[model samples]
Every structure is written in structure tokens, then in C-alpha cells.
Target chain A: MELFTPDSGLVIWMFISFAILFIILAVFAWPAIMKGIAERANFIDKGVEYAQEAKSQLDGAREEARGIIDEARRQQADILRDADKMKTRIVEEARVAAQTEASKVMDQAKESISQAQKEAEKNLRNEVSAFALEIAQKVVRNQLKDEKSQKELVETLMGDMK
Target chain B: MHQRLFRYMVVIMACMILPVFALRGEDLAGNSAAAHEEDKPIDVKEIIFEHLGDGYGWEVPFNHHKRIPLPVVVKGSDGKWHVFSSGKITDHQDYTEDGVTFRLAKEGEHKNKIVEVDALGNETRVTDMSVTKNVCAIFLTMVVIMGLCFWLKSWYKRNGYKVPRRGLGAFEALIEFVYNGVIKSTLKDKAEKFAPYLLTVFMFIFVLNIMGLMVVFPGGANVTGNIAVTLVLAIFTFCFTNFFGTKHYWKEIFWPDVPLWLKFPIPIMQLIEIFGMFTKPAALTVRLFANMMGGHMIVIVLTLLIFIFASFGPIVIGATSVVSVVFSVFMLLVDVLVSFIQAYVFTMLSTIFIALAQESGHEEKHEKKEDAGGGAKEAAAVTTL
Candidate 1:
């Protein structure tokens, strides 16, 4: 029976102690602790948000960087292809110009050579005619002394003409 | 290697229990009918009850006759207050002062309590407001809690809400665990409003329960096992649950959304709701008290087994002592676990109760009608606590 009994002294003390503890803690401790905890929680939340924002911004920057690099590579490829085509065309044009100049030089050289050859042939023929005329004159003079030789030369020339 | 270690530990434990066995053998030798008052047969019931109950003084270890007395405050029959050390009355002697006599009653209904006697030799109770063992223990518990709470506060104050290091960090973890796990999850937005009381109760009960496990100074008082203490805690829960309860809570209790027949005529649901209200706190009170008291009682009973086996000679006494020590040690460890659990359960239940009261049924009505069943289920969950 005594075991079941609730002592007033202990009850009063317990109530007083509990109330005092609650009051003291509620006023001095709980609010501070709770406020500190809540503030920390809020701080962590903001930190996470900031980190995520920074990460997304970094990702965007990286994407932009990738885009810039791709554009530069594309421009470089186009410029390289254009430079290769220009090099090919320029080489082909130079080769064609050299071939035309060589051909024109060769034609001019052939014309000059033919002209020289013609001149030489003409001179040779004139010389030959002249020599023949002179030879005939000398023969006529020498043969005047001899009427038979002159007469024989004239008859041979007539027979050749017939 | 582990097995060897274990054998060594058992041997060491047996060595420790040997002295206790020798002491009990001496005690059993005086168990004859003509023995002295201190050598009387062991009263297991008295021992268990005494250990479970609050005392006017803290019992000294290994010395049943003497105790460290506390101050006794009582009002005499002469309508005046008397203050004295409890040792004066607990020494099996009557204390007389200013024409009034007070004595601690023995072998009667008022046994183990201070009673006032008059010229007619009739014993009547005094207004005892002593700072007994339990009260002192409460003060000790309060100081410890204050130390821990203020330590945490100072840590936060200095560090600006950062997680504290080491033991203080563990303490913070416990606080956060209870607050976030039980209170905040259950009470939702209203958690902050009632967190102070709930957190305090949790710490109060937890520290008291752990402190009760100690057999030495500052730890031996069974404060939590007392009915009065648990009742006060329960009453606080009841007050908080009812006083801060929302309008919807009261409406649900008096006029629930049950069938019309259950609400009217017989008023079956209403009665059950009212009954459920008291039952919540009642259950809280008894559950904590019984669990703690039972834990303490089992340990004491296990210890008494050595004395019970003393008549069987040294062999039986030695065997019983070893078994008893091992079991009691195990039981004490279990009690430590129970202490934390009971504290957690008490706080969890209180949170649920407050959460139940904080529910606003308007949401259920404004939303789909099917959710109303969920509300009733929630109420049922609270009653199960």
C-alpha cells in the first residue's frame, strides 16, 4: 500500500523542480538552441542552393565554351579547306601559263629558222645564175678568136631548149 | 583468443562474487530465531519495495542500518512547522520538541513514514514535505540537465550554430533526433510551439531513468519509478494536449464524423472519445512507472537469490552468487536500454498526442472526401498509444 502511495512532499518537489527546469530551459536554453539549430539549417539550405546555382552557372559556361570551341574548329576546317583548294588552283594555273609561254617561244623559234633557211636558199640561187652568166661571157670572148667554138656553144644551147 | 578472454572474464566475475557470497554466508548464519535485529531473516518483499520506493535518506552501500539522511519538513499536530534531519526519526527513536512527538511508523499502515503522536497514543500523519531521497535526486537530475543544456547553449553561443564536437555533438544529435524524428515529424508546423515542453520532458525522464540505475550516491534514488512523478509528467502532457488543442480537435471529440446513430441517442462515439482522452495520459503514467519499477525490482530480486540460497552451504551460495551477479549485471544493462527507450516512447507518444490535437479537419473536407478516413485512422493511432 505504501508502495502505491504518492508522497505530497515528493510531488511538490517534483512539480517545483520540473517547473523551474522548464522555465529556466525555455527562457535561457531552448530558444537559443532551437534558434541556433534553425539558423544552421537555413544556412545549409542557402549554401546548397548557392552551390547548385554556381554549378549550373559553371555548366552553362562550360557549354558556351564547348560551343565556342566547336565554332572555332569549324572555321578552321573551312579555312584549311579553302587554303587547300586555292593552293591546287594556283599550282594548276602556273603550270598552264608555263606551258603556253613555252609553246609560243617554240613557234617563234621555228618561224625565225624558216625565214633564215629561205634567205640562204635565195642567195645561193642568185649566186649560181650570176656565175653561169660570167662563165658564158668569158667563153664568148675566148671563142671570138675561134669562130667554130662560138658557133658550137650556140647550137648546143638551141638543142637543149628544144 | 576471444573464448579464452571470455573464460578469464567469467573467472574474474566469479572472484568478485566470492566476497558477496561470504558476506551472505555470514548473514545466513544469524538467520536463527534468536538472532539480533540486524540479523533477522531476509524479507525479499521489503527489500524490493524499499528499493523501488522513495526514501527519507539515501541508503549507504553494504550497510542496511545507516543512511545519509536528508532534511525532513513536516507540520506537527500543533499547527506549526518542524524542520529536522530525517536521521533523528529514522534511527528507530521518537523525536520530541515543543510539546509535539514525531516518529517513523513501523509495522503499520503508515510504516516507513513520519507520524505524529499525542497524549492519547494515537498515531496520525504529519504534513511531510521532506527533501527526501527522491527530491534530492530530482535536484541532482536538474543540475545535470542544466549543465548539459547550458553546455550545449554555450557551445552554440560560441560557435554560432555549428555542429559541436565530441560528446556535446552526440548530445546535439540526440536532441535533433528526438526533435526531428518525433516532434517535428508528428506535430509538423506546431512542433516549434510545443518543442520546449516535449524536449524538456524527454531529457527529464531520460536522465532520471539513467540516474536510477546507479547504486551509489547521486544515482540510486528511484525517482522515475514513483507514481507521483509519472503522474505529474502525464498531467503536463494532458494539459498541453487539451489546452493548445485546435477547434477542430474539440469538435472531433464531442461530435465526431461518425454515423449519426453513434453520435446521437446513445452517444457511443462521444463517450468513447471522452474516455480516450483520459486514457492517453493514464496510459502514459502507468507505462513509464511500471517499466522502470519492474526493471529495478528484477535486479533486486536477482541479488536476493544469493541470500535465499545461503542455507544450502558454501557451494550453493557460490553458484547462486555467480549466476545472480551475472543476471543482475545483464538486467542492469537492459534497464539502461529501457531507460532510453521509455524516454523515447514517452516523447514520441506526447508528440503524437499534440499532433492529433493540432490536426485541422478543414483540409479533409476541402479536399477529397476519401481522405476523411485517413483522419479517423490517425485518431485511432493516437488511442493505441
Candidate 2:
């Protein structure tokens, strides 16, 4: 029972002592310690947030890298396609040029051949005419042996041609 | 490092041996002194009472004769203060003052009490307001708490909120526990504002309670076991809860949001609600005091069982002593756990009371709505003018 009953003096002392102790601790101790704790917590939060941001940035960069690779692939395919088209065009152009040159050569060869044939005919005609004149000269000389005979022969030849 | 460790072990061994030798010397001297008379039985109750209660001086066994004198202060009926060291009174057990004898009474209801006797032999009290052993313990506890708190404060200042690895890591867990578990769990968003008070109260009660469980100089104060001490803590909670209480809080006590019939019939509910406020603090007071004191008493009684059974014979006493020691050690372990738990419970409950005593609910929303309407109405009236 005495234990249960609190002495007033002790109560007063406790009251004042606790009040002072509480005030001192509340003002001095708690704020400083809590500040430290909050700062640490904030640091941790920032670290996590920074890590997440870096991860997202990495993802974005990876996507861009993929896009660049895809664009390079497309450009490569376009270059290959263009090379194929140009190669065929150059081959086609050479073939057409070669055919034109062959045709021109053939036309020149035909024209030269015709000209040579005409020349040959003209030469043959000239040779025959000369031979005919020679034969007439010999025959007239043997038959008449004079200007009279040549005239006569000329007249005879003209009468035979008429 | 190994050399340093060995040196430490040597120093510890020396300390242990020195204390044993001193105790043995004292026992030998006491035994020799007691050889002159029949050996008296040890009074277990008296030992327990002395340990549980405060004394004018700190007791030590120096040849088992006297105590170390502390200061004693008492106010005389002459309206003046008399200050004297305990050496003048405790050892001699006699001190004369102003025609009255101030001494320790060894009989009747005044046994172990300080009282004054007149020349005619009538005993009266002259206010035994001395800085007793318990007061010394209280101040020591205060010093320890202050030292730790201030030291940690400096540590934080130096380290800049870094998670303390070695310097103050011991306190970090308990501090974090109170803040996160008790303050955040109960006080919600208001935790930060009330954290300082709650943390301080928690540490004060915790250190004191843990010290109370110890059987040594710094340990055996039983400060938390004192009803007045618990009452002071409870009163702080009471003051904090009511002081910061909001309009909605008062409304819960004076005008609850119950049916009109319940509130208007006779204000019975409101009365009950008001009574609840005091009872909550009262419960806090009694719980801490009773738990600490009960633990101390049980441990003492268990230890006393050895002497109690010694009456049967040496063999009976020897067997009972083993059981007594085992049970006592078990209780002491339980006391340690209770000390921490009770401190935590008090802090958490106080935080809860703080939360409950704050402004929350539809009533606050209604108030805000009313304020907004009033502002608008005032603006319209001014415009009309």
C-alpha cells in the first residue's frame, strides 16, 4: 500500500525533472538525430531514382541504336540494289554499241564490194573495146593496105553495126 | 592487434581479481568480528526493502560496517534549510540540531526512517528531502542519456547523416525503430512534428527501466518502478495530447458525432468520453510502475527462497538455492525483455493518443468547406458595398 502511495515531494521533483529533461531532449537531441536520418533516407531515395532514370535512358539509347542499325541495313540493301541496276545498264549499253558498230562495218563492207564490182565491169568493158579496135586494125591492114581500105573497113563495120 | 587484445585480457583479469580479494578481505574481517557472538540470520526482507527503496547514503560492504555518505537536505520547522553530509548522521546514527535529536529510528513504524526527537522524546519529521541513493541514480541516468544524445549529435554533425558504421551504430536501430514503428505507424503524417517528444520519452523510460533491472550501483535504482516517476511520464503524455488537440478532438469529447438522442438525453456519452482522457493517462502510469516493481519484487523473493529454506538444513537449503538461482536468473531475463517492451508500449501508445487527439475526419472537411464559403461571402459583401 505504501508503495502504491506516491509521496508528493517525489512527485513534484519528478514532475519538474521530467519536464526539464523532456524539453532539453526534445529541443537538442531529437531534431539533430532525425535530421541525420531524413538526410540518409533522402540520399537513398535519390540513389534509387537516379538508377531508374539511368536504366530508362539506357533503354532509350538501345532503341535508338537499334533504329540506326536498321537504317544502315536498309541503306546497304539500297546500295546493293542500285549496284545491280547500274551493272545491268552498263552491260546493256555495251551490247547496243557493239551491235551498232558491227552493223556499220557490214554496211561499209557491202558498199565497198559493190563499188569493186562496178569497177571490175568497167575495166572489162574497156578491155573488150580495146581488143575490138585492135582486131579491126589488123584486118583492114591485110585486106586493103591503104587509106582506102581503112575507110572501107570503117564503112563496113558501120554497116554491119546498123 | 593480438598484443593489444592480450593486454586487454590481462587488464580485465586484474580488475576481476582485485574486486574478489577486496570482498574476501571484508568477509574475513567480518567473520573474525562475528566470532565473538552467535551468528544472526540474514533478514531477506530488509535487504530487499533497502534495495527497492532510497537511502540517505550509497551502501557498500567495507568490512561490513558503514555506507558511503551522500548529502542530506531537510527543511526545519524554523523555516530554514539544514544541509549536512550523510557522514555526520548515517555512520554515527546521531546528529543534534536546535535542541532536537536527528537520527535514524530502528524501531516501530519509524524503522529505517529519519526523524527528530525533542528533549521530551516526541518524534517528528522535519521533511526528509534528501538527495538519496535513488536521486543519485536518477541524476546518473540523466547524465548517461545526455552524454549519449549529445555525443551522437556530434557524431552526426561530423559524419553528415552517413549510416554510422562504428561510432553510433548501437543506438541507430532503437532510434529507427521508434521513429518508423511507433511514430510513423501511429501518428501518420504528424509523426515528424511529435517525434522529438516521443523519442525522448521512449529513451528516458527505456534507459531507466533497463537500469532498474540491474543489481549494481547504476542498475538498481528502480526509478521506473517509482509511482511518482511513472506519473510524471504519464502526465507528460496527458499534457502533450491535450495541448495539441484540435477542434475536432475537443468535439469528440464534448460533442461526439453520435445520434442527437445519445448526446442530448443527459450528456452521458460526453461525460464518459471526458473520463476516458484521464483514464488513458492513468493506465499508462500504473502499467509501467506495476510492471517494473512486480519484476523487481519477484526476483528478490525468488533469491530470498534460499535463506527461507535454509531453516530445514544445509542440504535442503543447498538444493533449494540451485532452484532459486535458476528461477531468479530466469526472472531477470524476463525483466530485461519487459523493460524494453514496456518502454516501446508506452511510446507507441502515447503516439496513438497523440494521433487520436488530433483533428481528423469529416468534421475537419466541413470546417474547411465553411471557411471557404465564408471567404466567398465576405468578398461578395465587399463588392456590393
Candidate 3:
């Protein structure tokens, strides 16, 4: 009945008890416990498979998005380049037309100026010649007025003229 | 028929020869003088030691009240001394063989002791000790069981079988049960590493405990009722706990930190905790040993009541026998439950102790984090107000 007695026989019995208990547990309870563990493992394995599938899908979507972005960028670059080329062509065409119109107007102005100058010059010459004939007739009339003296003067004038 | 006959003959011969061979080489020097004239024949239960007259020797005597083996010393035909006890023989022939000769005394006579002669041709009084038959039986049982387990395990492995069908299946199941219930419950991450020890401890205790039950039930054998067996097991646990215990565990036990106000009392608390550590395993040892021994004592006492009333009447004997049987059956059931529970408790406690020892630092870190979080929450509430 004493506690903590160093009874050697009890030691032997303890060993025996331990051995038998181990055997019983090993046989029956162990399998059930292992079944639980196996089920857990299967659950984890399924989770891992789902995660892998999700990862692969995400990667595929990312790749598709990247492809779309690249395509959009290429189209953008083409549109911008076309716009630049059209702007340059429009500006060059406008500059050429403006130059051509200005030159045509200048040529017309030069031709009209030359014609007007020639007419003005002819008129001036006729007017000056008439003026000069009138002056000369006036002088001749004055001199013939003195006709009486004119026969003699005419003779002198004809002589002087000769 | 010949083989059967040969086996019978062999058994008969063994029966005859075993006692004779066992009796041979026992030292009978001191007891022979006392046993010369006997009122009753002295039953020599055990022989402790033997020595030649030229040197010193000693022997201890015991009575055969219980069926356990008493330590025995013997000298073999090689003129050497040997000690037989605990199912093992330690040969001292290298030192004693040159100077001694040994022989068996008479068997039928009351003088069943070994006689040793020294180099001077003088008869020397030496002790004759022999290992007990029960001890030998227990030892043989252990070896056979272990061998069978190993063989089955190997065979299963070699055959590429998934699990054992019969005996091996039982063993694997027990292992897994301990692994999950005791090891996994007590140890979180490193259960597998500790599984073997836990399983071994559980199985060992359980088998022995059940053996104790068997001893009283039908084919009764008081194996676990013996103290020496329990002591060895306890010692094994003690050594294992100490050896595998983490440094942090020992530190916590010896130098635990307490609040500043309780600093003076910390030493006392630490002392108690240290004592607690020792007591845990000690409790394991005593709980198992007491339960087994208590059940056995009760059954024996109950059966003894029949003998006390033997002279009264047949009716009394019959009644007592019936009562004893009924009580013993009840006790057997209890013992069975105790066997499994004690094994589980021991393994679980040991695993928990190891786990605690190994992970105290982590627990402390977690606690500190919680405390800090609480403090931060309090500060945030104050600021919000």
C-alpha cells in the first residue's frame, strides 16, 4: 500500500503491460488513425492541384493581355506615322499652290504696265510733234502777213532758203 | 510416429536433465554443515555467489514464496566461475578458472548445492546460485516476440506489401495509433521523429500491463507485479526524458522568470517546478506499478478467503469461489482499461514534456507579440477618443 516503493517486480509488470498495450493499439486503433491521415493528405493534394490549375490559367490570361497590348501599340504607331505623312503632304501642296498663284498675278501686272507705257509714249510723241508744227505755222503766218514786203522778202527768203 | 516419439523422449529428457544441469556447480559450503541434520528438508531457492578458499566469496539465500528467480552463482566444467541472474550469465573464468574445480552435489538429498575445490586440494565453501525458471520464461518470451515482429516487418517489406494482414497488421495499427493520438496530439511538427520512441514506450507498457491482467484471469502469470520490471521501465523513461529534454526546458524549470513583485517567491516556485519535473515521470512509474500490483493483491486476497473457510463447509467454499470469480472478472475489465490508459497517459505526457521543452521560446515570442498588439490597440482607442 506504500507509495514510491522500489518494488522490482512492479517494474517487470510495467514492461509487460507496455508491450501488450502497444500490440493492441498497433493492431486496431492504428489503422483508423492512419486512415484519417491519408484522407487529410488527399485533401491537401487536391488543393495543390487546384492551385496549379489556377496559376496556369492566370499565366495564360496574362500572356493574352500582353499580346493584345502589343497589337494595340503596333496599330497606334502605324496610325501616328500615317498622320505625320499626311500632314507633311498637305503643307507642301498648299505651299506650291500659293507660290504659283502669286507668280501668275505678278506676270499679268508686268504685261499691262508695259502696254500702258508704250501707248503713253506714242501719245506723248504725237502731241509734241503737233505742238511743234503749230508753233512753226504760226511763225510762217506772221511772216506772210507782211506780203507786200513779202514778195521781196519771199525772194530773199527763197534765196536765203536756197 | 517415430518423430512424435522422439519429441516426447526429448521433452522427457529435457525435463530430467534441466534440473540436474541447473543444480550442478552450486556452492554448498556453508549450508551443508547446517543442513546435515534436518527437521525438515531445506529447499535451496537460490545460490548467490561462489569463491575458492584461496580468495573471498559470498552468497545470499532466499525462500521460494513467489515464483521469481533468485540470483545464482555457478562454476562450469571449464573450472571457471559464472554468475547467473536476470536471465544472463557473466563468466568470471578468466580469473578463477586456474585455481578452481566445480561439481554438482546430490540431487535427491536435501543437499542440492554446488561444491568447489581449490588448487591446494581443499574443499572450499562456495555459494550455488541459479537463475529462476520464471525469469528465463519471461526473457524467452520477449526475445521471441521481438524476433517475430522483426521477421514480419522484414517479410512485408521484401514482398512489397502495403500493410500486414494479421499480427503485423496489429503492430502497424498500434504504431499508427500512437503516432496519431499520442505523438501527433502532443507533438505538432516533429511527430514522426518521436513516433518510434512513443510507440515503443506505449507498446511496452501496454503488453506488460495486459500480462499482469492475464496473470490473475485464467492462465495467471504475475509478470508485471514484479517491482524489478517496473523499475527498469521507469529508469528508461527517466533517462530518455533527461537526455532528450531541450536546454530551454531545463532553464524554465530551474530559473523561471516571474513578475517583479514575485521575484522573492520565484526561487521557491522554481524549486517546486523542478521537483514537479521529476515527479511527473515518477508518477508515471508509480501509477502503473500501483494499479497493476493493487489489482493482483485484491484478486489474491479474494481467493485466499476460500482457503480460510475451507474447514467450515462446502457451501461456504462454493460461495467464496463464486464471489471471488465475479470480483476478479470485474477487476480484470478495469485492469484492461487501465493498461491501455496508463500506456497512453505515459506516452502523451512524455511527448508533451518534450514538445514543451523544445518550443518554449516560440511560445514566448508569440505571447510577446500578443501583448504588444494589445498595447497598440489600447493606444489607438485612446487617440480616437
Candidate closest to the true structure, highest TM-score: 1
iRMSD, all candidates: 1.0, 1.6, 9.3
TM-score of each: 0.85, 0.74, 0.47
Error of 3 at B281 (Å): 2.0
Write down the DockQ of candidate 3: 0.07
Residue B335 error for model 3, in Å? 2.2
Give one digit per residue, the lDDT tens place, for model 3 in B1-385. Answer: 9999999988855654453333222222334543334324322222110110000111222422222334555655454566544222222222243445543333322123344545664444354334333343354445544654565556544654344568766766666677766678556666755565566667656665665455322224444444455566566666666677777667766666665444354477676877876765665556565566666666656655655654444455556666666677787788788778767766666666556555546656675445435543542342222
TM-score of chain A of 1: 0.64
Write one digit per residue (lDDT tens) for candidate 1, span A1-162.
776677888888899999999999999999888888889999999999999999999999999999999999999999999999999999999989988999889889888888888888778777777877788777778776677876887899998989
Q: Is the docking of candidate 3 incorrect, acceptable, medium or high quality?
A: incorrect
Number of the top-ranking candidate, with lDDT as the measure: 1
Q: Is the docking of candidate 1 incorrect, acceptable, medium or high quality?
A: medium
Query: Which number leads on DockQ?
Result: 1
Q: After superposition, how far is residue B114 of candidate 1 from its true place, in Å?
A: 0.8
List candidate 1 stretches off by more than 4 Å: A55-93, A125-162, B1-11, B17-40, B259-268, B365-385
